[model samples]
Target: CRIQRGPYRCHEKTAGFNFNYTDDPNYGPFLVSVNGVAGNNTELTFWELLVQTGGNGTIIRPDVGIGCYIPEPNDRIILKFTEFVSGSHSVSGNSSNPGNLTAGNTSRLDSIELVVVNNISNTTNKTYSTDIAFRGVLIGAMRRLQTNSGFNFTYTDDPNYGPFLVSVNGVAGNNTEKTFWELLVQTGGNGTTIRPDVGIGCYIPKQNDRIILNFTKFTTNSASGSCTNPGVLLFLVGLFFCFLI
Candidate 1:
């Protein structure tokens, strides 16, 4: 959202060339969008390949998506927006709003157990099996819990970390103060407790994951993990530039 990726509309000097596209309300930017007239059954284009023409004029489409594609010097980027049409391939454009990300048929993962521990002693202050949502991230679960239930918590977006869990039950943490909240997961039906190998955005809960938002403090280099993966982090990261809501 801070124009760290590309086409930063903000007042920032050009570090390199970047492209601009609309942040449509219906579908995301990676899903192609059209402004003017379109056919009735037009669909959102799925960005196929991110062609990087090197100095030697060689093309490459990375195994990952455009959101996670890293750029190097002397690289030419070509974005191919394409879609399938009646057993044929065609250019991508705005056909209609993006399809339902999570269809209505999914009703299995309804709730999850959330254990809130304050400080190092790990005293369980609040515990409940809140409803699990299709938010696609841990932050979304917090937001949904706040609305569906009465769970109270606050967080800030770190340029490095996706969602900096600052305070829970009225406690806040900051970088300079060497204090921050950490996330821990209890696996195997809540028997074993271990820190997640990855950040919250990348880790999707597998039904019975006991999400523990622990309040802790860190020293000069302790709070090191901040998220950069754009696939799931885009929705929250873009808020720093301009939140849709």
Candidate 2:
């Protein structure tokens, strides 16, 4: 792939890898290639971009990446290659304040980042961070991450609880058989675990929050908790009445 970054340009090609191509239905194709070298053919140091601007030189992150953005004749596509102090957004590092693009213009990257990990899989531990809109429910974030970050998540909408998370990357959390999707949150660097008080559709995420959706077993004792079962309770109550008679 040929990439143009400002005055520098290069052609990058890789086999058996799909990281460079991000295809969207509406926006066409955009390139997020990481292999572009300088015109001198040195190793390309940053992610590729096709930035659309308002001619004030303020560049907004493209609605999508290269494979998804079909260019218009009048559109300004700035090719910028930059590095991140923290390469964790999966594709983004420390972002230079999108404010550097200038004021009064809404062309800025306004997204949040969340890290996802699954304890159920035995595969090599690979790390990926999901970057999505600054404001949205957890399901919305999951959809965005599924597309951009190359992770898989599935859910079902229940009339009672709204959106119930079914699984992550093919690992299902069964609620009836005593298995569940446990929600764990870690804010800042705190080592303690905080269980969320809300469901996926109701909970909103804060920046820098590590969200762990774990598939785990229910810990209720069958003897004590079985009393909550209507069938068992009914049978026990009938026996109590017989004793009184």
Instruction: Give each model's whole-structure lDDT.
Output: 0.46, 0.41
| Model 1 C-alpha lDDT per residue in residues 178-203, reported as the tens digit of each score | 45566677874756877664444334
Instruction: Give per-residue lDDT, candidate 1, residue 90.
Output: 23
CA RMSD, predictions in order: 8.3, 19.3
Best by TM-score: 1
Candidate no. 2 TM-score: 0.41
Give the least accurate 10-residue stretch of model 2, judged by summed lDDT: 93-102
Q: What ranges in model 1 sit over 4 Å off?
A: 1-44, 48-79, 84-110, 120-123, 159-161, 188-191, 219-245
Position 172, candidate 1: lDDT: 62
